[model samples]
Target: MVLAELGFDAGQILAGLKPWVECESPTYDAAAVDRMMDLATYDLVAAGATIERIPGRMGFGGSVRATFPHKSAGEPGILISGHLDTVHPVGTLDVLPWRIDGNKCFGPGVMDMKAGNYLAIEAVRKLALAGHETPLPVTVLFTPDEEVGTPSTRELIEMEARKNKYVLVPEPASADGGAVTGRYAIARFHLKAKGKPSHASWALEDGRSAIAAMARKILQIEALTTPDCTFSVGVVKGGQWVNCVSSLCEAEVLSMAKRQADLDDGVERMLALSEEAGGVVFEVTQSVTRPVWEPSSETLAMYDLARDVAKEIGFDLTHGSAGGGSDGNFTGAMGIPTLDSIGVRGHGLHTLDEHIYIDSLVERAQLMAGMLMRLA
Candidate 1:
């Protein structure tokens, strides 16, 4: 389906994008995140969206929701999700200046999400400029602290997702620029072990070492993995010094399972192991950060819409499943038709080399605008 050509001012959009990149809104820095939210609020309002700011817990950045109300049919809106926070801390912006070289723009949070946020803004702007009234209302949910598991905004995301027919997530496209159709479910857990401390040289046999117990548990968890299910112990902390027996140790484990049942099974096994270890008191706390984005008829239809939009723009788009998780995972788990990886393609997300293709700024914006026009 051919929608009206988007009236995109690429230069102006880029001009708005630069300052956003310069604002270093890290996850834990509430003040910096508030500044980024203010910029987004201003831009969205200028583009005719009604903005709402949701305060987050202390020490964490808050979230913003912008609604572009459609005057046509007044149906349940489409939800566009993106994060405004980066993985970097407050001082990162000074160290990592935003720079452009050839076709790529590099800086903190560029590829990971800030670029995606800009694309969403530009899409809404183009639609407004083109005078395409959506049949359904459209809402853009921009959250800070997604990099830290979205604890504060998870309920908000779920509530908005349930009210919408479709959810579009602007996470950066895969390395090949294909859309991600599915993502694995993630359950993050922290395992803490407590034991009696003693002098290592004299009473080693009399005392129980939590660190030794943790090492054994780590190896056991690693052996429980397969191709479909994966587990990793990312962070470990314990031991006061080399001379004394450790009394406490904690390890953070990330578990990925294809299905919820698999996740349950994995957790059960872990709990069993924790119980089996002698002389060690174990505590396990699990959080379901993102559920798996399984394939469904609704998801396929969403992909069809994206493919149609891509074809209209003289490009063919492909879809793939991924192991990484996003808020899209939550929407997909809710049984909504969710299309992810709808943003610019680049490299080094969550790393110092993060960058976005400069050309994708225009192309992906057009694609998003076209899809919204047709779908709405």
Candidate 2:
């Protein structure tokens, strides 16, 4: 019945999602992200939620923590968590314009989670309009920096999860149409090299090649990849002048593992590497680290409950482990019950082609509404 209700008024949901998708709240843009926050506050207020604006003094973007009181209280509450920031930079909308083509609705941050965030708001709005009351309290936290590894809101997410019974994260649904239960532990490093510089024509023998060292180190790092652990080199920069040997070079490495032991070992081995290539030295700095989210008994039980919910709506339910980390990773890693990828189905995340299924706009909201009612 709720599903039908959502489907009937899908246009309203799109009205709410349009501004959010077009705002282009890239993680590094504080003013733009705050504008996005203001827009979210408008929706939460309309849904009868008490809004708390956590200022982005961290120089990123402010976070919104909205509370919807329950008619009857028993547990702490449900922590509905997500991030508003997208990987797309400013002016991306110019290239990746939002449009609707059949079942597909194309936009910048639609599927990666702008649409998912609004699904919760629509759910609550529907419940309110229908005179439905929640069985337990609900807190929605939309932070500003998930695309950039949640640098500003990591502790806030952890602390907020401590107050809730379970964390439901609406990132994107898995490629196989399953919710994500497990997420790989992730780490990032910036490796730099320093070497002697000399003229290309006159002092070739006296010069040291930092670029050569970076290339050699990259080869060694690639060897660290395995079935359990993986490493990726994302960016490379070197050489100030063409005629002189490069004195400095830098590269970024992204590593992931399913288990902490493997992560520890891999990170240790990667950091331990300090080999010389063409008489240059390499140094590595750990920039970001998010622990793996291994499923707990309570989490598995929640998944079972979700499966039942999906079945009741005539859809098959499934789940899988994810390679990317989310805010759920921080909570689930702490042994808290967390459900991820409970959002709309679409593709091309972090790219210009990011989008959500037009039909899922209503379906997911209805499903989440059912979840809130049943789980509570």
Candidate 3:
């Protein structure tokens, strides 16, 4: 509990976080992500951590690993995961000011999750300054492409996750200020349809319209969803002009299923519908970004540890699930004891009005520091 007594400089942390919000590290912008990675390395090093940048497989944006190695070896290391990418395009930070109105601070990537990244660094700094030796080695992993899908860093995350006993993901706390205990599994698919184009007014009957075929498939896909399992056609791009028949159409479908069986069934139904549209050529690209985090004995134990730490610091903590996914999903899928959403609480992620609670910067930092100390 003494770890909770170590006061962190809230001003300094916020100052660091504000400038970070200015960095436009969107999913596809590799150069911007690389810059953000450098910033993360610089911040962690200033916090007394030994930092290294692990090169990604295909020369994409790499992940940064900062370690506070214990004096003894063979201790299970704790892997703390967060991402550097936001969904915003370049120059969004200037458009969204880092202004505080009452208790809330509004800015781009403020809550989801530039603030989380800063909190993780400050927690380690507080523990180091307090001379608190952890029971395990602490390693913080910041990936660059999590906002899109962790295609670049998945292998590295999985590799480091297996080396650790526990994985703590600081992916912005829930809207109600609760920590995340579980997350729904996401199966995303991009469906493309191809057909013959013809004149809209003349010879329309001779043309096999791809857009029409896609509409039928969409209806069938919508019917396959249930309460426990949901599906949506989030993106659709096709067609050329009003006077011509649409020869191509594409849609991006996102499926949130409780179990793999449901996911498989949904996929099967979608593929079958594509096959049924005989006139159109269909292609589906599937991506399982995050596996569902179901409550288990190990996860419950981790939650108990967090709750005990929260009580020691006079903070009330609760656990729940979210529809979103994080690096925690990868570790949870590997059966590691993982706890997520331990960062500052805020709202409007992936939007223009995203912000973090001003007070949460210090409070969540204290909470994470306490959890690290207890877990250590």
Candidate 4:
């Protein structure tokens, strides 16, 4: 394989990726994510790429934009995109410690993304070391808040993507070693339930508990799930003291739909949920949203390029629309040709057992290098 000819070393790649996996960059922790950005910046600099850092906004960590030097610099080229944040919070390493068992390597964000991002970095680094210039200039954008639907970075993502000819997302490859051509539309909502506070022992009957009201709202939100649109409550916070009746409760809700119209209807229904139950008022506010990206002819053509690369690398690549949303959603929805989930192959995403196959390191790196060299 060309990876072998290029001296791609799985051991070296895994060693280099260990620090990223151990970084523990949960989306909400700006400091942790910034540390990750710092790490990536250091690598890009060593790869001889010019670096631009955009400080975080909307209470999120900053983003990194690295541009490789080429004769076609300042022209439309390939945009290599990914995120530094993982859904697993800090200290998840205690349970999902980095370990290599058989062909699988385990860590908090190994499969979901850290490995893929590292692969992109390594591909550029190695290609530079080999003195090979890609047919087009390459730019890298690493965001810090994709885990929360990219509330702060969506506009930045789209803006940077608009300057590129194509976008390659290093999200985790599918279970069947496939790529992502389309993504479901996703919406987020903030829910609040308010009630009268009183002494629980003396006026429990007189006071309406917001926690109880929130519980009822959760059930209602769950019942909104269907074959077309699915809703779930992911975060909830309520009472502060046991002796007092809770006056306020809050929750974060997420909804996903295969079609834009279904997601629109779901958002309407979610916002229409304002009501008062026994003096406890329930209110919902829409938050960040990801528009549905149906596979366009351009996107399918990009996937074909990826498939051809995989075949040359001695593997078969398949692609389909997936449920989870990535930064690809923004680029694809904007009608930019995008190939996503073109990272390492693995499973157990967003779980304690998240990991990647050990051998996929060089294979994916080869595919990335091929795309960089072949895309014009």
Q: Which candidate is the best by TM-score?
A: 4
- Point out where model 4 deviates above 4 Å: 1-3
Measured by C-alpha RMSD in angstroms, how accurate is candidate 2? Answer: 2.1
Ranked by TM-score, top first: 4, 2, 3, 1
In model 3, the runs with Cα more than 4 Å from the true position are 57-60, 199-206, 240-244, 276-278
lDDT of each: 0.83, 0.86, 0.81, 0.93
Q: How big is the RMSD of model 1? A: 2.6
lDDT of 2 by residue, 1-376 (tens): 4456544366787777888898888888999999999999999999898999998966898999998867644358889998998888899999998888888888888888998899988888888787777777889999998887887889999999998888899888888778999899999888999999999778988899888888888998998899889999988999989999888999999899989899998899888986565578789888879998989989998899988888877687699788888988899999989999888888899888888888776667767888787775
For model 1, the stretches where C-alpha displacement exceeds 4 angstroms are 1-11, 72-74, 198-207, 240-244, 276-278
How would you order the candidates by lDDT, starting with the best? 4, 2, 1, 3
Q: Which lDDT tens digits does candidate 4 get at residues 16-67?
A: 9999999999999999999999999998898898999999998999999999
Query: Per-residue CA lDDT of candidate 1, range 1-376, in tens?
Result: 2443675655676688889988888888889999999999999998898888898774677888888766643357789999898888766767677888898888888888888889888888877777767667789999887876787888899898998888989999988888988888788888998988999998888788999988988998889898767889988999988888999999898888878778778877766765635788887778656777787897888888899888877778899888768898888888888899989889988878888888777778877887676665
Candidate 3 weakest lDDT stretch, 10 residues: 269-278
Q: Model 4, residue 332: what's the lDDT? A: 96
Model 2 pairs in collision: none
User: For every model in order, what is the number of clashing pairs?
Assistant: 0, 0, 1, 0
lDDT of 1: 0.83
